[model samples]
Target: MARGAASERDGSLSDGVRPGEEPADAAPPALAIEGLSKRFGDGAASVLAVDDVGLTVERGSIVGLLGPNGAGKTTLIKCTLGIVLPDSGSVRVFGADVTDGRRAAYANVDAMLEGARNDYWRLTVRENLRYFATIAGVDPDSVRGRHDRLLDRLELTAKADTPVRELSRGMKQKVSLASVLAGGAELVFLDEPTLGLDVESSRTLRRELRRLAREEGLTIVLSSHDMDVVEDVCDRVVMMANGRIVADDTVAALRSGAGDVVRVVSADVDDAVVATLRERFDVRGVETDLGAVERDGDRRDGGDRRGPTAVEVAAGGDALYDLMDALRAAGVTVEGIETVRPELEDVFVDLTGVEPGEGGSDEGGSGEGDLSDAAADSRGRSP
Candidate 1:
């Protein structure tokens, strides 16, 4: 078995999912956010970025913070990390009041927010790690030992002597991440750590992040716009849109949202046939979209009636046999069960309607909503 996983090479390994096959019931919370709200500028034109949102992240568990562009995810994260002060809210990192304690509380916390804070352009990757570890008050000698191992694992051993300015974006990202681990932080915060990495590098980073969190018993809070990243990495997910938690549940629980999408891949699927599906399932989701595709429709889209599709309802733990039975009874052709599964992309698109940007910046764009979900899902809320 892989560390923090049900199986080796399981998608869950890189995805950060722990389905708890134990057959037991209930678990403890690791990190909790309570009634957290952060508003920028006050009064009349105050922009409410993180409004009364909360959720819990468990020890030795991976959780994802998801939302669309301008959803105030960054603001909330900033507030949690003490980078931004909240108007009214509280964030607990490893059970510490993050907004109140400041540096002392952050001593046990290590983060690579926006993946940009880890580098020293003049220093080598190894040098950077040494410097950060030293500053974090970790033993100097321990830095050397850990540096070698991190360089090897991150495939940066060859680049140990390379200047940060010379490395590629992905390489820099790896180095930055290594610095976080080097600090020996008990809790890790990574916001889009793999944003620009290539596929292989991204996969390795994901795999390693999973291993680090589980095997080392590190608590992690990860924010990402990639549904695959979130779907694969989180044990549970907390979604924020228009500055609030809209959906909070296990990935398995969220997949239940996609309990309806059925991918057909046997022969040709013509327009008429597609049209036939439209009449039955909410076919509006099938249109060409620039965003990631989920099993049924959008989970992050945040639009009422985002689109309906049999694929989504098909997900919520429903058996494919039942679906085939329904399809056949509906007079729809059964092309061969290519695969019956839920799509996280559909789940994300459904709720926020847009991909989450690095920060709630205007460049990535924001969602359209008159949200009343101002302060939902705070960890304080009773389950």
Candidate 2:
């Protein structure tokens, strides 16, 4: 919504035309990087944080940047934001090359990294918004209405005059996002934007982000460990591993490509049954319905009243039939069976060999260009 005034001032919105209405000579992508490579150190100790990566983000789209720690995600983001210089690559923002000048390239960009630390804790919420807007080369008075709307939407109007240090973590996180938007940035990067938010606040922020992208032609590159948020909000997901882009596609496409799993719920399933199934099929997990077992008085101390066990097996295509045969041979009575579509989290784990929310080494090479670097970068220019 803030971009309306910004477009008039700088023509950042597709060179004065609205989104999807660009002329034959349309503007370049909101952000683009080619042959991007970055490494820290040298010799045997060197770490290739980004390995010849290339990426493009279109305007008015929400793309999820997903990867586990040490997957080069943080390094890639820092390089894109100009916080970390790439060893070899070219970064272009809104048709302007970052090498030529970041002031022009990232003029309409902003970011929130490391949660609420991006904001000035001593400043009031409104003051922080105005301060960031001024630094972004926009008159705070010109976008006061936009700031008000952001505060209202994020439920921070009541705390507008309150010092950011006095607010709760979630509220301060909201302030950080509001400050990023206050400058009418057309492209934004948000890392863990909903890190400390409650359910209601998180939903509110997601709704607003979607509206901003759809209505204001804002482009977002979001990085988060929250798979549910990424699945719900992102139009496309780009996953990285070992400094390489392993998968990039829509959330639905990624899930579909991950192959379907079969879940069998059986009251007779036990360790022996699970082992047998594992021998025949790839058993993903075996979860016992503890509540159901308690209700049936099937505690271990009681009798052999085993409760229902849900066995998640990778039994797609012909494997399903063979799995059924195995179950029949085992004399197991299936209570229910259904095809389980892989979630984004499942796809992520399959591709990266890392569990969701798992943390690893600092991808920026010995923790270089981390949150502290991001904070310092955000203060000087568009993050």
**Top candidate when judged by TM-score against the true structure:** 2
Ten-residue stretch with the least lDDT total in model 1:
372-381
Stretches of model 1 off by over 4 angstroms after superposition: 1-30, 42-44, 115-117, 262-281, 284-339, 355-383
For every candidate in turn, the CA RMSD to the true structure comes to: 11.8, 4.0
Question: Which residue pairs show collisions in model 2?
Answer: none
User: After best superposition, candidate 1 residue 297: deviation in angstroms?
Assistant: 30
**Model 1: lDDT of residue 233:** 74
Best by lDDT, which number? 2
RMSD of 1: 11.8
List where candidate 2 sits over 4 angstroms from the true fold.
1-14, 20-22, 270-272, 288-304, 363-365, 374-378, 381-383
| TM-score of each model, in listed order | 0.71, 0.89
